[model samples]
Target: MTVPAYLHIVQYCAFGIAIIANSLLLHLIRMRAGLSFGRYRVLMISFSIYAIVYANIEIFTLPVMYMQGAGMIFYVDSVLKNHQDIGLLIAVSYCGCLAFCISMLATHFIFRYIAVCRQHHIHIFNGYKVYLLLIPPFFLFLIWAGAMFVCYRPNEVKRDFYRKVIADLYEEDIDQVAFIAPLYYTHQTDGSVLYRISDLLGCLLSCGILGACFTTCSICAYKTYNKLHDSAIQMSKRTRTLSKQLFWTLGLQTLLPFITQYIPVGLVFLLPLFEIQVGKTMAVPVYLHIVQYCAFVIAIISNCLLLHLIRMRAGASFGRYRILMISFSIYAIVYANIEIFTLPVMYIQGSGMIFYVDSFLKYHQDAGLLIAIVYCGCLALCISMLSTHFIFRYIAVCRLAWKMEVYSTEFLT
Candidate 1:
């Protein structure tokens, strides 16, 4: 089925906002003072590229589906007709996703290796040499590219061979291949066992790498915290504050993706095995899509908070938490009202409002006005929250610098 126009608009707006925010974040990190640029810079760049590619692919592919619906053509045929473009889009997106995942995983492992196996040699890698960091991600890209090329066979192959190839790759039942293959071709199932197999492998690899990284990072972080706690000399308040911010950022980053991707996928897959109705199967995937998009939006917004944490850690004056609280409150109020009112209005008025406006108002204006007011109000509030959070953090960092200088002079005297 084609995506609704409203959803297309929403997706476009979301992509636009995320790209702008992520770009600004990259700039801030580069310009920000006293931040550990070497350690976090690659991570941020990888994530930003991943987000951009993901959003673009969604935006491009949805319209293709929409065109198929409008023309009453087969969706799979349309996708194949546009295969070169679509393939490029998916290739770029998956590459970025792989880079982000592998880099993060590698970073954690390297840190763990240094901490546990070669503590004395840690300083040798302190500057985070770009050449060393790029090696793992580059290898990951090459592997993904090879798999994708193999999976995306030309449309003339026999169905049985295709299914066998896919099943062999993913290790799934031949029957299950039929379900996913329709996505790529019209007469024969696109359920190239190959694509599913590759995807399954990719997911497993990503999970394994991420698991190792998290374990190592957690251990290192805990050890560092304990060591700091045992130190009796009056600890620098700046150091303590910075540690807190870093901990919060890392914790949120580690947890959000699993909640967004794995949990939803697990729930969807489990529902079917439990004998849920076939009709409900679509609901699970649909809901999963929504949840995934929401997660992406939240992750992008959360980066704004990350910037604030970096500023605070750098001993820059981050403005009072009260401002952030107030900004959040304003956003909550606007969002809650929009959510509470929109459904009721849509239900109570129904299509009657459309007819009413067309007949009486002669312009069908009120319907548009209502939607505009609700959306605009919510958007305004979100912008306010984002702006205030970043500004307050900037102020806080400045304050930290002033305090640091004062303490330094007093100690010297």
Candidate 2:
């Protein structure tokens, strides 16, 4: 089969599997653990909504099957006539999905901040704090919806519908000629510019929110993990397990989106400079879909593992959760090294042999030395940062201990 057909099958299958897995895991959590379905409820709901929107886009937009030897062929007959309603539904759902993701991220960071900064504060344990965490995203979504309503004539544009359909249909079979035709047609000035402006604003706002959440969460995670490592705090097994669960879930949650979506999008934006143009644009949609699907799957598995860890550490059934977490951590580290390090090194070597060998020959001695120096410097910097982070965490934990000692002395006096 053609690439498009393969992608279609893969995308749909992954979506189906992820949804089923998440649903079953979530059901098990609720039944076994009397856990309040608070923030996780939002996450699961968002996943379900995204699955429906994504599947609809996949089915409606992509070609059904390919014709043998005729290249990628689309079934034009099954196309929906009134995709306007679908577009609206998708847009609303997508906004909600984004809002929920941001809310969950924000809540995670806020909780971390409270845990680290006000660990002794009794009010911090109050359930009301959870409701308070939802306020920001709720208001942000409302503001966005209001602005979109005021600014855009939703009826005038079919771009979202068209793009969704075209993306699903042609993503795998992406011939430059075929791709550019739809892109040109879609960009034609047919609607009030308000819709475009609204979209731009929404994108900017979402980016800002995500950036803020990521920054705050990174600080919190680094600090918390550092303290834990340095102080060697004899936490209850439950606390240690919970902390690990939070660390891995929130860490992956923050990092994966950047590694997958943001970085790939940035690379696409920089493609103009490379001038090596063998279907570079086609890579974007494919990467976007792959990243999104992978991130969601990882998130679901992480959350499920987290639930299991919480239960197991809190005196439930077996110690299987600890084994699962350890297995996952090992797998993730190995996968990261392979994907991020080994594959990239291989690609660089292969590409250098093919393209850079002749260029290197001309500036052989100087270029080789400079490249080695730069590589070594980067490696040194990474090690230094890691060391500094650990040292700082140790110092902070020591300070906390001193404060606690002083308080104890005063109480005794």
Candidate 3:
């Protein structure tokens, strides 16, 4: 499927913003005095690095996907094209980073669990404890990566492998080796089977670890809260507020990976196997793609707000042009909202309709009328603003104050 141009445009814009914002954030974290210490700092720095690498890969690959007209197709052949080895590595990178993300979250939850339930023992575990815990995932990632590389059989005939992969797309893009081989089967030629087995193993391991951490954290948090509530020991207001904030932050971060990675991956892999129909509107991977763009959107909004705040604080006088600048700002806001709402709605609802002025008007008449009015109003406002600016400039530059005063007096009479 050729991706809609609007989607491509949005993705590019979002990607750009995300890259800048993530880089800035990483720099700030590294440079900030208070944030540069402790277990939290280490984990955050790791996350920032992960995010930067992921964004870099996306920046490189997204344009290729967009230009090739691959749309939302994620098949290895379509995305990687002639560079099959690199493609396989990219796939491995995706899974490895996913595992890394899960491990990070698990570690975070464990820390929280200990801090809440066994604060005295936290020092015993220390920084070395985190290092030990993180090492296993790296080893696991290596094992998973090596297994995936072998599964594709890069040393073998490329054409044969491509055909096999394509043939198996019907059965979730598995090779015959996967369908025919037993779960425990192990052979040099059993690339596909090993791939499936390894994927399942990695996923199971991540889920098990994450689940354990989450359960522990939940129990600890509840117990700690209750214990504090019942105890006569007084906690400082600042301490209580910080604890509450940390609790919510961790809770939100814990939920993030599940929605963005786990659930979407689950649906994509499982839905086909079960032959469940989720309707045309359901695109599980699309959700993941959209989620990837979220960082960019957030960055864009944040930067805009920050700049506005800076201007306000600096007391930058707008003078006679304040109204003019304000008008343009409002116009920009309205225009952005209109396109954001209208394009997505039309594309999703129009049922294969291309996003164009004619198609939209033809398909959604009332909406078209409203849109037309908005366009004309915006154009009129823009022209009026320009005319007002030119008139003022002429009055100021050409010494037309007397003419303005005479006109004002005639209007008053």
Candidate 4:
């Protein structure tokens, strides 16, 4: 897939931001974290490092995922595109990170629960034993990646099925594209569908991992919350307050990924398991952007050159059309600056579509929205300008009656 120039801009921007942000987080965890953190501070720093790794791999790979029916086509649009073997690892690592994210969060909650409710087991996270806390997430990470690599083998039937969509959506031949697709439903000679056992089992494995992690987090959170509330358990005022604050903060943090990652991953599995056919509209709008930007660049250059030529001609040859072209050239430059910088990523789900902008305008909510609107409004004007430009050309070239006489109009004529 041809990556959007703006996507590279976005990913690199995000990469820089994630690096700085996570670096700061690591520093904060070490310096600012109080004595109460103890062994837990080690876990926190490890997770922050994990997050940095997560962001680095994701940004580097820049995988564009499109879900179709029960299957999904995952491919990279990055520097790694030519290196399928490496890209494959990066892609699998990206998937593993998803699992690790869940498992790590679960560990955090479980650790908290143990610290508050069962101090005896807290030894698992102390000193060198602290590294043991990382085992579950890392284990799940490998398992998830292994399952993805083993189960989602590229085959002829799957290739044939995906051929048209690949061509239409990505402008890439199915044969040429290296993508991982796991189609759950297999069609037979009689047109009856048989369950792809590999796909089903993969989903089971994924679901089991997800369920266990979520369940652990839930049970620990519940027990820890109740334990903290229990007046019977003796603790100092500062200790109690700090524990409660950290517990609630972890709970809130867990909620973010649970909502963002877990729920969507569940849907990816559950929707197909129930055989709900949600039609996929794979309109990336990247094609439009490509053509528009390419034309806009030419427009800027050619129009500027034309204006220079008209300047040498002293505006007598092209007249008001020269002024119009110059105005359009200026407009094109302004439009390019605004739209390319605040380029929107659009997503389609079911019958709805979403436009997301995570550019510099992200902090300014209303301004971001207004800028998006302006960008879109400019696009509409560009469309209108195309027709208007052609109409004026038709009048000048084909219609003699309405044609402007060269050097005939002295003033407003």
Best by TM-score: 4
Q: Give the Å error, residue 107, model 2.
A: 1.0
lDDT of 4 by residue, 256-329 (tens): 56655676567766776665534334444433444445545555555565566557655566656765576676
Among residues 3 or more apart in sequence or in different chains, the pairs in candidate 4 whose N, CA or C atoms overlap within 3 Å are none
Candidate 3 lDDT over 1-413, as tens digits, reads 33345645765686787678878878877787262135566666666676677665554444211000100123332345346456556655654565566666666666655655566776755666656656755665665445444442332233333344334332233222121110212224544332245434534454555565456556666666664454464666655555555565666665656665666555543443333423223233244334434433443454455456445643434334444555555555665555443333334564564434332353787876677567557768768878977775676568667436633435535
Q: How many backbone clashes does candidate 1 have?
A: 13
Candidate 2 structure, TM-score to reference: 0.48
Better of 2 and 4 by lDDT: 4
Report per-prediction Cα RMSD to one decimal. 11.7, 15.0, 10.9, 19.3
Question: What is the model-wide C-alpha lDDT for candidate 3?
Answer: 0.50
- Order the candidates by TM-score, highest first — what do you get? 4, 3, 1, 2
Better of 2 and 4 by TM-score: 4
Task: Look at candidate 2 and tell me the lDDT of residue 17.
Answer: 77
Using all chains and alpha carbons, the TM-scores for the candidates as numbered come to 0.51, 0.48, 0.53, 0.66
Candidate 3, position 86, lDDT: 65
In terms of lDDT, model 1 sits at: 0.46
Q: lDDT per residue, candidate 2, 353-392, as tens digits?
A: 3212122222565754455444445556556655754554
lDDT of 4: 0.75
Kindly indicate the candidate among 1 and 2 with the higher TM-score: 1
lDDT-wise, the better of 1 and 2 is 1
Q: Write the per-residue lDDT of candidate 1 for residues 320-405, one digit (tens) a residue.
A: 45445545744554464444333221212544542111112224466645754665577776887788677656655667774455
lDDT of 2 at 76: 23
Clashes of 2: 5
lDDT of each: 0.46, 0.45, 0.50, 0.75
